[model samples]
Target: MCKEKIMNSESEKDIKISKRKTSYPINSELLDYLKSYDRAFKSPIVYDDLLRYVDNYPILDKDENDTFWQGVIYGPQEMSEIHQNLKKIYSRLTSDGADKSVDHLFVDSVDYCTFGNSHPFRIKIKNQFNDNHDYFYVKKADASRIYGLEIEYILSPNRINFLVFENTLVEEHISGIPGDVFIEKYLDEHTNKIRLAKEFVKFNERCFLRLLGDQRSYNFVIVLTPDFDEMQYRIRSIDFDQQCYEGKINLYKPQFFRENLDYVKFVTENLDESSIKQYQHEERALMAKRMIVGKSRLTKLLRVMKNDQIAPREKSFQLKTEIFELLKDNEVLKCETMGDIVEAVLNFILRNYQTSMTKLF
Candidate 1:
């Protein structure tokens, strides 16, 4: 298989996502779920508090290009108050809310970005003795995004570190090369294109399974690790605003996005359809194992999520039909909410895998 193998796949121009997505409120059920999982607590700084900034200056990357973020300015009196609380919030997210953990840390920068849906405030922290810095983000706590984070934490290999309060969400920064940059600057020089392609297939499958949408190249990240002999690659979703919110099925799959066409083509060139399918199965089996271990927590989440309204009725039904087209399972038709749809799909995978295992014996 090569370029012609995926001649009909999507390009960047084919997809037109909404310019802005509606932010769903975190209702009581979701709040309870977060609390039960230790993901929700009182925060010293709320998202609205950060909005009281006086002005902002555009931020630039090392190449002098706009980074789509701005350095927020605040009054000196208010700045000191906010920075101290922000340091406290960081300790909560990373150190289980210990007050003394942030004594040596200082808030280096409070940057704001209005380029996307969340309009998050990026906080940069530096150590007093050493210049080593770390990053975190404070954003409006949207319920849909919370579900995405929980699903990633429960199902994916990557762990999500975050905390949520009344209307604020604090998340540790996900460190990786921007996916677009890796595709352009590192792919040609990557040590193991085949392994990378396999991971792409698995990543694509994982996104589709969880109904996590809008995974364009720039929206996610590429994590490269040096194995003893070869390079291992991983694709991690950094943005979760679109989790189970879109109507179109393709939106859930990263391979269909125009920004990811290069990876799609590279995959076609290096791997056959059978190899792609094998990787997808491997990913599903791993997720199913995780589901078994996290069964109680996942069940609690699904119950809460099904009662929460994250998507419009029309969009939810549209997605149900589209998913049924591929999965051909009647359980999908029973879904009344976006959460129900997620549960159905996951149960479908888990049940099918369990059945096969039973038959093997």
Candidate 2:
């Protein structure tokens, strides 16, 4: 009986080892979980440090116009804490077999006064972080507000300050908002602004398909580089924590590019037809292929998410549904050229939406 029991225990051990070998790696496991839930798992360590710094900093008494004196830097006490988090992330990036240090991969210029509660910073890396360099959004976790994480990114590396603000253009309420009104409210005299916004939404649809969440307006910015005598606004994502989706889900659709017609009309009215066609082509070319995952891997991962007994909630659920209803006719996204995307990016900047309360009628 003792001999039989020993043999059975050995067999069980072998099965467990085999399972471990066949199971997904730890990094992939965590990434898959985030994708399944449509959530960006912000780093806890970074969030804690940011909180500590913000807590001790003395609020500035100056007026809002003095953006530079906002006292946005993290407090002195948080220096050590921030350092620790940076060290940890750096260690991971430069671990035994890692390709490069995070800093070497991207230039780091920090910012503390982001619109979001979390502190924001600029990351200037070459070769685009995973072919996503144009712009990416990332979140650092916190126990406080659910949207406690910060959203930020630079549109291009060659600019005055690559760290530009990305305004989500959506209202703060999170629910009961109309998408067209939001854009109209922020629409600018420049025709390019509307075109840029539309192109951005189209690009965003790609992100949604990958199971990445929180593609808020404030999460990214449009960059305009002066070429010869002309100016062009390009779209780029700043945050990247959610780029690697474990699931193989594709949410691409024509409506996503055309659902909000009012906003599109508002934007296109300011542009020439030639530019619009150009943006349409650029969007299509980018969406033609999925470069991030292999067929087998994507298939297996998406299946796991589908099989999991979980129901996910919308991250920006508080936004007014009435406004989003306007998202039903987004004609701007249908453009087939970079010109439309450029027009869209520029139009928003021209609108100067943050301080505008003007009557469009």
Candidate 3:
């Protein structure tokens, strides 16, 4: 039997609804920021164009299980037009409008998912010469998701490449083993369980500090890399729809998710309170350093985010109050939007860093 008995804590139960009802539209200021950063482009195609597909079939995984994806098929003339436009877009994304590099590439399949908030279409491109393949996503652009992508690019260790054109957002695929699959298949085989636990601690801290939410096991992936002697694991969030939209503070922390109980159990079993605190501090320091390095760009983005509305007032107020209660700092109480909450968190980190420095003098 699998060692799945470790997730029995009362706190492991699902506490809040995980889905968001509506997506916030991208506003003007955020659009300007995207345009300024070369993230906005003009495209011959938009998200609605893909909806003209005549038929679709259920996409199945290797085990013949329905993957919640439909293989979209368009008529010949429409397919030709779409394939050409998609190739051009792919060139723009990867080669800065150099179409010759992807001349030999062809669109293999387009898969759409209707289950989630974004309702993204997954595009698969393959090289005719060597049959090498790559994937990308085309989704209707949402302000919250855009902010999440930018924050992940700036604040996290990973760099993401994406572009916005009108209502469509194109995201480069992030490759990794889905977290649930990793927990089911690789958890027992992983030699360095402590490192895995440490990574989860850091990931939890990162998500909470940035106010990202809904990071259940299915929403993120675990990447494994071979170190000189051992393996290193990194957990990256793939779904960005729920970024900073929840009322409860615990929603921002991945450890609170029932689907991630295994990871939480790992941390609780292998790490003591002191170690967890150290990991959190370490992540915070790294984030602070990243902020310093990207100060100009980050500040500009935050300004746009602060002026934009991504969540309801009640949700924002609840989050602000919870943050203040947690820190015993009332500054967050003045935050009006989700962006303001994020700004308050950043400022709080800076203040803590400065105080620590002053103690050394």
- For all candidates in order, the CA lDDT equals 0.89, 0.32, 0.87
Candidate 2 stretches with Cα past 4 Å from truth are 1-28, 31-46, 53-55, 58-78, 81-216, 238-266, 270-282, 291-361
* Candidate 2 C-alpha lDDT tens digits along 1-361: 1223222332232211011111112234434533443333223253333434353233343443423212334655565455444433433322432334434343232334454433443222233356423212222322111111111111212212111112111011112223433454535565366546455434444443232333333334455556685445544443333322111111111122233333334333444555544544444333322212133433444333333322112211211121124233233244222222222322332233322424543
- Per residue, candidate 1 scores C-alpha lDDT tens digits across 79-184 of 9999999999888888877878889999999999978888899999999999899999999889999999999999999998999998888999999999898876
The residue pairs that clash in candidate 3, if any, are: none
lDDT of 3 at 264: 79
lDDT of 2 at 190: 53
Best by lDDT: 1
- Can you give the TM-score per candidate against the true fold? 0.96, 0.38, 0.95
Lowest summed lDDT across 10 adjacent residues in model 2 is found at 15-24
lDDT of 3 by residue, 139-183 (tens): 999989999999999999999999998789999999999999888
C-alpha lDDT of candidate 3 relative to the true structure: 0.87
Q: Which pairs of residues collide in candidate 1?
A: 11-258, 12-258
